[model samples]
Target: MSDPIAARPAQDRAGIRVICNDHSGRNSREAEAIDLAMKVLGPQAELCHVKGSDITETARAAVRDGYATVVAAGGDGTIMAVASALNGTDCTLGMLPLGTFNFFARGYDIPEDPEGAARVIAAGHAQTIDLGAVNGRLFLNNASIGVYPAILKERETVYRRWGRRRIAAHWSVLKTFWRFRRPLKVEIEVEGQRRRFRTPLVFAARSAFQLEHFGLQGADCIRDGGFSVFVTPDVGRLGLLSDALRLAVKQMRLGEDFELICADRLVIHTKRKRQLVACDGEKFLMDGPLEFTMVRDAFRIFTPPPGDEAAA
Candidate 1:
């Protein structure tokens, strides 16, 4: 009977805000995107330019100003900040892929053209998706702690210089596999049961696929409130990475038992106090004693239609 979203009270006016990271290397596109949003969203929409120096503060301020829908326009980091700001609030969330490596955008298939994305936003067919919290930081898509996170932190400059594709996520995934010296030792608990395993990386997927060849469409949708746990145990490192890589690229169905696990919540303990975590595309070092739970139908999103649209 009561409305679930945290911040905004139910009201008549559609309070919407566009939060853009103008520095995402796609500034002109961003400007056009905002223009399209203005046309689509009309009088209710407001566009706010956010500086990188204070992403968190600026995003929250927009919500505080009464934005019922806050569209984050940039790469995954900007999404992280904007969504985290709006978490537990009543405001609806939206995405605009103005940055490199729009993994989150891939989840939604947002039009590469900013104007098209604005049209999708204007249509306002809102739906909900699951979210996760790691040491108080929120994640909308996936989180990986271990070699991937390490590589993300390491290759920040490489990504900036060579570009997102220059140090592609899979490339980093491979580089971390071969170069990382830190052997991963983690104790995992899923659905109240405990198990221990050693792995180079542990990725927590909240309702999405890492790759289409892995039957990514069959992969959980984030709003479903489930996690697909990727475990690499006892497999040859190079061969396993290669297999997973091929599976991803080819969009193949992965072997059931060794490569994946599905659960509603997971608790992970590591030997180190802080482990690197790559959530969606934002990298950070998080405290151990990490717990992730699948949140069913937690937050609202706007996506394309099924069949041809979704497949696109």
Candidate 2:
């Protein structure tokens, strides 16, 4: 079947609305990039600087106001927020990638440099892309339960206390690992097969770029329009730490510490009625059993043409 997300011809750049998050990254360059983007997009484009909470409503308002393209100028979380509002809509989504790690933007081949990304937006080519949903909440990158969310919580606390830095992130990791020792007992149903696992993490990935970013060899699964479910086995602290190190170094073999399952849909059941889930860096306490589904070609995203590295 022909991919529904195949590239479309460039659209008019006159009616573009950019929804920017004020708190994306610590670097002054992001602010400069936003300014540069506004200049590149010209007077016709509408730029709205918003707090994290207002992203969705602002994007939706843009759509209601009939914008040809609604640009998300922030990180994965910011993009995902705007995406949740724009998914299944006809409006094209543009990305500025003004974050520490722009997994979605970079994965889609959007340039890391703000000026370069702005140029791509001005050019105005768009392609449809898939999104993953957990309990009906959309995610552009991936969703996870277990140690990941704990780590994120700690990372936020540490970031606030010590200011954001690489060492703070590492310290958060150590703190989370030391404090969280309980593994989740989950019953996962996929492809008509039922299996139970005692594990520390369950990851549902929608972006091939994220898989490749982690040096995992399964981008094809994402391209096939399914969730690549990664489950960490019931490894102890030392084992978990070792596997994490291997993953960091890109040497963690699949089927060893982690089991990968590709599925169009999955059911993850746990004893608790509500559990914390991390979706593209946002935290939610959602009710289980969590139903995960792949929404193929759910988002129409602006990008430079394929093979156009110079634009990137």
In terms of lDDT, which candidate is strongest? 2
Weakest lDDT window of 10 consecutive positions for candidate 2: 1-10
The CA root-mean-square deviation of candidate 2, after full C-alpha superposition on the true structure, stands at 4.0
What is candidate 2's CA lDDT for residue 290?
A: 97
What lDDT score goes with residue 45 in model 2?
A: 86
Please list the residue runs of candidate 1 whose C-alpha ends up more than 4 Å from where it truly belongs after superposition: 1-8, 25-39, 166-171, 213-224, 234-248, 251-258, 305-312
lDDT per residue as tens, model 2, 1-312 = 222222232352238898889877667766877788789888878889999999998988876666778889888999999888877666788888876568889887888777788888888778888788999889988999999899899988987787656577767776777677889999999877889999999999888987887798667888888888899888788887777678778897888878898888999999899999999878999999999987777868888887787665
How far does residue 134 in candidate 2 sit from its true spot (Å)? 0.8
What is the lDDT for 28 in model 1?
Answer: 51
